[model samples]
Target: MRYNKEDLIEWIIRERQPGGQMFERFTERARKVIVQAQEEARKLNQNYIGTEHLLLGLI
Candidate 1:
């Protein structure tokens, strides 16, 4: 399976809708990094995120 930017963005939007409690405790900066990580994963054409993606997000 491959991932594109649109699909990843849609997934993020859907996950942020009401009833999503997973990120409730996360700081705004943390959330931004996660979104960036997803973008990194999409850029690599990956269906899932890895440590490299998170590192890139931090960078």
Candidate 2:
């Protein structure tokens, strides 16, 4: 199966685990950073988010 950018982003945002709801408390800029991290992971064909991806997103 293939996941598009929007799908991946949504999955990341809607993660149904502990701290999932923490996303709701994030500032708009922080949320954008998460989205960008997901995008960076996708670009690298990675299925998981990592510090490097988050750093790239921040950049």
Candidate 3:
């Protein structure tokens, strides 16, 4: 897993962006974790702050 966005950004920064493919690798539960992580990274979308319900639903 990536430590921070700087790491993610540095890793993803490229001449041609084939993005969003990263998310495709996630299972439903794993995807939820990633979505929550991404929201926390942005400091936006407070809905992801309380994402346990998503975990419960997915599981």
Ranking by lDDT: 2, 1, 3
The TM-score-based order of candidates, best leading, equals 1, 2, 3
Tens digits of per-residue lDDT, candidate 1, 20-52, equal 456668888887777788889989899786999
lDDT of 3: 0.54
Better of 1 and 3 by TM-score: 1
Candidate with best lDDT: 2
Model 2's number of clashes is 0
Roughly what TM-score does model 2 have, to 2 decimal places? 0.62
Ten consecutive residues with minimal summed lDDT in candidate 3?
Answer: 14-23
* lDDT of prediction 1: 0.80
List the pairs of residues colliding in candidate 3. Answer: none
Root mean square deviation (Cα) for candidate 1: 9.3
lDDT of 2 by residue, 13-56 (tens): 77844236667898878888888888899899998989999899
